[model samples]
Target chain A: MTSQFPSTDDVILGPGDDAAVVAAPDGRTVATTDLLVEGRHFRREWSTARDVGHRAVAQNYADVVAMGARPTGLLIGFAAPADLPLAWAEEFTAGVREECALAGGAVVGGDMVGSDTLTIAVTALGDLEGRAPVRRDGARAGDVVAYTGHLGLSAAGLALLERGVDGPADCLSEHRRPSPPYAAGPEAAVLGATAMLDISDGLVQDLGHICRASGVRVDLESDALRPEPALLEAVRVLGAPAGNAVAAARRLMAVGGEDHALAAVFPPETGLPEHWHAVGVVAEAPRGSEEVPEHPVTLDGDVVERGGWDHFRRE
Target chain B: MTSQFPSTDDVILGPGDDAAVVAAPDGRTVATTDLLVEGRHFRREWSTARDVGHRAVAQNYADVVAMGARPTGLLIGFAAPADLPLAWAEEFTAGVREECALAGGAVVGGDMVGSDTLTIAVTALGDLEGRAPVRRDGARAGDVVAYTGHLGLSAAGLALLERGVDGPADCLSEHRRPSPPYAAGPEAAVLGATAMLDISDGLVQDLGHICRASGVRVDLESDALRPEPALLEAVRVLGAPAGNAVAAARRLMAVGGEDHALAAVFPPETGLPEHWHAVGVVAEAPRGSEEVPEHPVTLDGDVVERGGWDHFRRE
Candidate 1:
């Protein structure tokens, strides 16, 4: 039967066929998969099906970008109750298409199944276009650490949402739809990034992943990482629930998850790209026989104790 | 951290990396995804976690093969409760690796999340090696229809399982683990098969999908589609509660789901590959002035009325 699904340039073969065929110019494919379950990664009362679909694609797309690759296609698996409205499914697909278009990608194929609770799984495929993949283990001591995109906005959004703050709450919207720095990854790679990762977890916590992978310590300058004025305004709008808005903003910036910003380490002599913020520096781990530092991530010489979200934790 | 996971040659890159890199020699990638949820697709009391994992991969792998491609890599997303035993997760991954190896593929990457119930989402990738994909719309009126792999075994096994039939039950075992004929797909394509598809939703029902897509009628001969003795024996073991065991076997062979068997249409001049059973023929739909046949599939010249499993049905 003829399909009503939209088609795009990247998808040589689209949905309705047994499988999709997509172009891979570089002779290699970069792929990643992520799953989001209702009540765990999202809540129906809090997120519309459209919001959930956008969020799922946004996060998985970030992973491919973190590898310094351009997304080519997406394969999605959605399991929802049979009683779910057809309108919800349509809107969800629209959201998926919207996000894919934003990344210059296409939804090539998908599967729908009946389940008791809603679940969405997305797999993104990308092409490196002849560039080497930027891995988390390539960072070296003395490299500069930089980031692109907003940091603690999503976390502040969540706080405002929880507090039932009235009127326009940009943080709440940011929480529902994370716009990751898609182009920044490939740009960083072109600019000779030593190592890279996406900040799905908080800044300090995600940088710790880089440190552990590269066997180096990352030191953030507190002055450089001070919460942005927008986040401080959000704190003011929330009426300073934490009693000290600046400290609360700092804590949120360090430990809140799901921002999906791009973070990378570059050689000292490399020219930093526009909009890239230099926030930290990579250092060698303590030598043998020397005491290990209390933290792999230090802010202005102070060890950070709070970490990012752990799904396995009992809350 | 060092991985305890097993490795394979097909994997250019493996888990724990942000994303995986797999070879695509033909400059194109064939991809498909499927989702299986607990209680909906499998019962924990009936199938082990390992069995569930194998079934999930087998089904998704069949789709890639149906497109006349060689399976390359798989990306899996699993969500389950935090209280789930670590052993369950390990066994599940082992099952995935085992099935992928059988298909000459590898488990390249995956994601894990905490949820109330178990859900497995798998996306399979493949390389066509420069051959044109055999789509379901390419079947012609004079082409011969063929199928490879077990037909009614899984359904008969389900029946025996539901009846609590004791004694040797190979059909029950088959239901727990599907083994699709992966090699036959590329072979069929090489032999110039016209159109192809995998029989995950019974013989007649799935053939109807091909018929609708190709805009042609498909005719199955009863003599050519006789159920294997093993499946008939299963019907006998269940005591033919619905009456004639032979008739029950015939219906099961025509309407059972989840078999993961490969079916295709080939030109009459093309020599049929070994292991591919010729079971039917393609025919033209009624003329322009005439009304289309009520059924796209015909059994021994009679229209089939019993449909296959529909997940969205209230029943």
Candidate 2:
């Protein structure tokens, strides 16, 4: 563990000691944790050790970034059987280093233990840079909902993989190692985003969480929430039926998870960040709608009924 | 997850947000992560879910405290099968809350995922309160080695459990939930201690780490390092021959892990803090030895060869 860490400026103390001390110059630290289990989160046959490592760091770092914080350090824990190869550990460590460098951070400490199966857990820390955190409960009526990064590529990719269809490498990689819009989070915060979160569990499902927290309803404009070209191509290759492509695309965009996109609500007058696209508008719930259905997210006047992944439930 | 977090002053932002923002008033944060896997680090039949949770938090918090920092927040990740009882999750969470409160911290955020078996990972954050962190490499030749809290009770407890012996409940509880001497870390720092660490991997084994890092040898006085009465009683009940109790006690003290006792090197002239006992002294390595004696820990002029737990290897 001592030799695994490379000295970085923000790390005052590194892995050899009992704990690591990281610089939190803004007097606060943004922290989050994630777990990726073999066969459940990723199959060993489908993902390389490097892909697993990169994906773990990317998803955890996305949470910190969505809070408008710049990541500074990571602490990881791995549990694997004793028979696991040392080369796998080395490759995984390299992947962690690569992703942290890409996100402008470092792995200062970690722990390893023995288990029956492979498991990786990462906790990422970030510096807020003197700004108040952009929380999920600050969305309000008339706030414009915007997002940055790929929307449905990950879901489409998974769909293709599930069907055993030979697909584009980029699409499969999207499912393996997502490329979150890392810089856009703090940028949105700087551009006066009122509320923000990472879209890890499908856009609609995660947005519903924000709606419940903020007590506001969100109506998405289907025309504005278009799927990416990769997702469109995947839908074409899926070939559900003639004229079914549009519905398939819409379904993928609405309920696909693991995109790691940044979703934020900004005042109507505030300009959206460069990479962000406006997709919806926040509104008050209808006062007396006993007959009308009540839902947090709607697309072009229709409720999105599909649910995202729930760890404890089957589809 | 939102309802699970009670508002705490140190947690500026809690579970509902993308990530938790915790106050780190001294411009630095201490961090550590640990993983507890079912049937490896813990066994479902032997430990209650609550006991697993408490032990996980206790061990990780000890690492941060060993750095002379006061724990402020925790971020946890748990992976278990979908069929696992909800009551177990609730009990584990309650255990986390209880331990955090005991350590003067709170659970700021957490994530849950599905897996074949139970795995719990925790990342603890701490505040230094303007003091420089005490590291492992600061020990010097003439420094008095001191320790606080139980040294062999955990091992003795494990022995009783393994043999199915009906022993004292306190010893069994010590194995299930270790109560680390959390306060002694910052106290040692404030009292001008040179170096510090938690003895989680047995006395001689962990002391060897301090020796290798500080480039000094440690000589432990057998009388000063004797086991407590409880451990002696446990040894008596084990019925190793009448003359072997002392050896049994010494073996337990030298190789017991999970005690979570704070070990430090303080200047001889400085007064020892309350609850701390002087047990050894740091000394220069012997000269003209080609092999460097192949060991850094000497117990009553003999090198201790009994090994502690190694995660990736069998004993």
Candidate 3:
């Protein structure tokens, strides 16, 4: 299905035959799959066909980049209703093409099918370039938690989109077409990150994942998490992010989803990538404390409750 | 998402992180994707969740094998309605695990999402073991076309199921959970096979793909393609494969879908792997033919019109 596209240097064999052969020079491949369903992940009314495609590819690419790998190619599975206009597909794939190029990858292959609902399944592949993967289980007790990129702009955008109010163009555009920090992945790996992941399910919830896997607690510095101005404004407009502007700003940054920021832990005193800023500190649970903390993630001294998009329950 | 599965030998990093790291020792990876949509690819009334999972994995595995590669891992994207039974999801992934084991691979990672329609997107990855991929464009004029599995059992089973008639259990079971000749893939490359692919759409249409890519014509020997007794019986009961029983059997063999048989072109006089049967011979188009054959596939020197399942056109 990818035969129409010109072949790239990394593609040893392009699509048209039974399968595509991509160069994996490092002798290992980093692979991840993501699903985007119409109405659930994106609404046609809220996003242009190209925006939908960009968001889909961006989400999958972040997964690969978070693994400290260089993107190689993608195997996409697109299913849609028959009545969809041909222009929609063209624009969507065009978005896929452009976004993939940004990641130094190609659309290696794909399957197109028909269904009652529009759906997209993207499997992003990457080459690790011979580095040991930065896993969630590798964090040390004294590591510092840092994040690169916005924390809640996507959530802010969603708030505005949901209320049919136009405010900050940055938030609105980002929610429609997210731009991930793809380069930060390998840079963090080189900088000796102990644990890392893409922030898709909000900073608090995602940090909790790293803490649970690494057997530590991630305590955020509330001062460092001062809500971004755009997000604060979006929260003010909604008046419902948390029932009040200040609380809503904090909650929006805490649990807003789909920003695809890189959240990573580095050894104490280690220098981080320029764009990365310290957000929290990783520590063992208080010694001799009768039980583990209720929440793996905490802000200042208080546990943050879990709140994020629930995919299945939303149905 | 695949963290619960026991780690396999080929996996360097298991799922739990943003992505999976799979061993690709040959410096390149073979990739292919296939989508199975509800109502279009399978009917829940006719197939168990396990059956659906098996069929989906089988099709993707065939594509990788056709590239003369050894299966390494699979990344699956599964989406279904919120009301779906939890047992259904469990049984479905169980089937994915078991089927991937057949090709010496593991379920490395996957994404689960909510959608109005049940959809599955499977991407199979493979290691070529350092051999050149067996592409369709490599067939020589004197090569003999061969096959290494049943060609029409799945199609026949579909016919029987569509009519709600009692017929061959082998056909029915195979249609639900195909057991492709995976070993034949690497073995064919070792035996100097020039071109190969899995017969997903049909022998005729798929071979036509090879013909156009290789710039050669494949002329079949009628006697070599005698209809299988089970397929013939199924055709007799259905009375719809074609107008007449014999013609129906021939059409079923020529245009059947989902059988996923391995078809290859081997140099003349090359000894084939055990169980492979020679069915046709590759040849150049006759001198001064004004145009390419309308259909690259021919039977007894006559063209066979195209017939195969089309994914998008169904809508």
Q: Give per-model TM-scores.
A: 0.93, 0.94, 0.94
Candidate 1 matches the true fold with a TM-score of 0.93
**Between the candidate structures 1 and 3, which one is better when assessed by TM-score?**
3
Better of 2 and 3 by lDDT: 3
Runs in model 3 lying further than 4 Å from the true structure: A1-6, A240-248, A287-292, A307-315, B1-6, B239-247, B287-291, B306-315
Which residue pairs show collisions in model 1? Answer: A157-A171
Mind giving the per-residue lDDT tens digits that candidate 1 earns over A1-315? Answer: 114346667788888878999988877889999998888888777777778778989999899999999999888898888898888888788778778778878888888888877889999999988898888888888999999987888877776666666423556767898889899989999999989888887888888878888888888886676777777777667565556767656666777778888899999998897778899899998872133355788988788776422211222
True contacts kept of each: 0.86, 0.91, 0.96
DockQ of each: 0.78, 0.83, 0.85
- Scored by lDDT, model 2 comes in at 0.83
Best DockQ among the predictions, by candidate number: 3
Instruction: Name the TM-score of candidate 2.
Output: 0.94
| lDDT of candidate 1 over B60-101, digit per residue (tens) | 999999999999988888888888888888878778877877
> Model 3, residue A308: displacement in angstroms?
7.5
Q: Which residue pairs collide, candidate 3?
A: none
Specify the CAPRI tier of model 1. medium
